[model samples]
Target: MPLRRLLAPLGAGLLLLSAACGGGGEDGDRPEPRRPESSDPAEGAAELMADMSLEEKVGQLLVPVVQGTTAEENADLIEDHHPGGFIYFPDNLSDVEQITGLSNGLQDLATGSGAGVPLFLGVDQEQGMVSRLPVGTRFPDAMAVGATRDPEAAASLAGTTAEELTALGLNLDYAPVADVNVNPDNPVIGIRSFGSDPALVGEMMTAEARAFEEGGVVPVAKHFPGHGDTDVDSHTGLPTIDKPREEWERVDLPPFEQAVDADIDAIMTAHVFMPELDDSGEPSTLSENVITGILRGELGYDGVVSTDALNMEGVRQTHDDGEIAVRAVLAGADQLLMPPDVEAAHSAVTAAVEEGRISEERLEESVLRVLELKLERGLYDAEPADAAAASDVLGGEEHAAAARDVADASVTLLRNEGGVLPLEEGSAVRVIGSGSEEIGAALRDKGYALADSASAADTVVVGTDGARGDAEQKGLVADARASGTPVVVVAQGNPYDIAELPDLDGYLATYSSVDVSREAAARVLAGEVDPSGRLPVDIPGTDLEFGDGLSY
Candidate 1:
């Protein structure tokens, strides 16, 4: 389990892959890949690809989801169709032991199937709200991490999260959302993003990318071309970013630039439409001008490029799953994630190659890159995820303590007028609003008194989820303020909730609803830790800027 540990560019490795295939591209004839002679004594990483059939090569492009939890439920996918990997969801997991066993079973099925290069076994374990694993160290959102203004925290979050993922038989993570959350109203990318500042997002993303890969997991920085400025959620519908090219260059493109410069191994595309970037009106995920021209040509990202979930309504608008797969490859994407019908999509790509619509060189290009990633991350020589040690390694005390430390540092005290924070020890407190029970329990665990009535309490603590919008939260805060006791609001969802309730005597922005965030907010309330975090994003209705926050 040394992991081979190559945390840098695959420059020479890629050159060898191409050279082994005898060099193929638009510039010259890409004849069939040749095998080394008996006397040649030289073989390349792509030799497995060269030996693969068209169906096998097409299947390698797909990273689909398994039907149910067990390996037998979708044994056909691994034992027959031979998809390059799988994306695990909550339904596919129960606990560390079950997941480890499932991962081993799946790998066993795939070992003798197709070209036998091993599955990627990925999850959306971004550590915060976008997590899929049943058990792991729970950390705050990217915005919360951004609030800490510490790249090392981001690195620690990723490195530790990666260890747990590998222990549970997962290798790839779709994380470190590189998108700068410029739009406060964005339905999808709010807490998932770093913040409004592209520079900050870039700094955090580079740190995370380096750490996750170095930790033996292939990290994928996601929602490329930036999903930040859109008000619509691409999962429900296609959102358009109508920014001019200049604004895109200033706000959305810098983090991706930093990622490429940092030698990131993979980037997942946004399904968002950029009218200025590609006037033809295709979303960035399917636009050749955006993918091949901008991401590949402009930013010079040489690593693997994957489309965001194809089953989502955003990309499914123009084409069916089959055509979308064809178009994504034509647009220069190397991986297709979450296709509704993997078999149809795989068949479509195979037909595209057979009909000469997609050159053999083009298909091999992605296959080799896919294989190279497997080799680079030590997946090529990997065994089934170790079931015995998985339970102990995952969600251990050290990782939880690390998660709380990050949450503690990310507690941004946006407003503390009249010094209404750091509630007195053992003072009766009334906690209400979203996640009230959990927040109250966390406080009680820290030895704070919980009052049943506001009149009996020294302070009234209210928790709120402002990410869904803040209208009702205003009323809840107004009611709490009416109590004779002092009012303290914990903005657990979005920090901008503070702006909605200007009357709050005390406000702490946890920026997430994760367990550690709540515990950290409890610690902050109990005066165990200092509120050291600053705002990572600007408040929409308030004058507070990105770096504004107060301490005890």
Candidate 2:
């Protein structure tokens, strides 16, 4: 059958829904919506909600991950289940053109729902290791921005990310991680957070959140109630936080509170358990006291509440997928993100309402909240994104330059003993580490000579990151130092790499290994740009505190 013919019945259902009570009228057809055509989002949502069925309303509470690559592969799910939103993973994307088509197709399918509301297409474009989009400007991570101590740079990064997201038809970005990384040994959220200082994290995150809002994307301040102090990774097991309320208020809660005050439209809950907030030992994603009592009650956040992916072991290990969905909604989350089994989740939510375990009114409350955000985002009136504009909008020269500037401003001179940096242009330098190849290429492109081996070099430039604590790399640096050759260490991950090798002649920390960051480190080594960034976190057991850096 033809595509339009296949879609006609679905479109007809939305067209015939009654304006007052979700059924056919006296003449066997529904009338148009009767509310005043004003700009009030609540009034608009209420008018639409009056016409939706119980099954349709429940669907609006879910933001499931898509399982298919094309519209035809997933059209049945969208048409039957009516999920409020969808989040993309790397698996669902191919290129800019494919992503644009997929987004437009999903929105087209959404228009066929009884409410005709647009879907909230979200992606984890956090830019460091968590970036999801296949074609766009890739910026440095959160710590890199924190190292710069310039909120405007953070805002610029978010704004550029938003532009690329919008061009590909995404309406929301799960980004601007507000967690204050108090524990340097934190497994999952190491470089994802802005910094350890609550005030500084708040300042930087608020700037990015506000920028995302202004740039036409919904900003999500994530891992609410704070995921920074914990050491366990939520993806594999639950991390427990035992801090008292006062301690939480001091270190963890400030950044999220700052984000909320900045008018962030959504906040993603963490899967980590905070025993002080709720004694039940459930992760925050399923804790009503944490979600309803703390974030909504104490924080006064009236925006949409999104849960982290339900498939993670932190939540999945404790409950069935269906139960996890039901519990998350009852706990006050407006969106059930990335449920492991979408059908099972839908069935369980439906059964809960049918069995009186969940009231119809309670379901409606979350559906209303979801619709309000959609209306506020202008999803009701947005046109299909232009697929042809993807190239023009993404990875442009302006964004590249912005990323380079941010990288340049974020390279800190952690320990420049004897002023050994600003290496001579023709000096034989040996580069090594996780980003050694990239760093070497960038430096050679800038007129620096890379020696074939450390022994043949006048100076050795070693690159290190949080991923590897390679003793072999340390041995090479030590050998260079022992030979009376200058050893310049570039930290491309956690700045603590310097503390691990304390005997270096010079040290620089870039806080990230993104292309721009590596290039910035190269330029600094070749005397192209002076080191200007400060340390965002402390190098534990050393006197190198936060905000410590040196310039040429």
Leading candidate by lDDT: 2
Off by over 4 Å in 2: 1-36, 467-476, 479-483
Candidate 1's error at 402, in angstroms? Answer: 0.6
Model 2 TM-score is 0.93
Over 189-274, each residue of candidate 2 has an lDDT whose tens digit, in order, gives: 97888889999999999999888888889988999988998889999999999989889998999898887676689999999888
Clashing pairs in 2: none
In candidate 1, what residue range of length 10 has the lowest lDDT sum? 1-10
| Model 1: per-residue Cα lDDT over 1-552, one tens digit each | 111113112322332333233222222222121222322212344566666778878888899987787766666565457788899999988877678766765665454344555778898988778888768688998899999999999999999998888888788998879998888788898889889999999999999989999988998998889998998999989998888889989998899999889889899999998888888777788999988898899888878898999999999897888999999999999999999998889889999999999999988888888877776787644545555577788747998888988999999988877887888877789999877888899889878888998888889998988733666777777878888678988888777777668677888999999888988898898889999999999987888999999998
lDDT score, residue 208, model 2?
92
Task: Give the alpha-carbon lDDT of every model.
Answer: 0.81, 0.83
| Every model's TM-score | 0.91, 0.93
Quickly count the clashes in candidate 2. 0
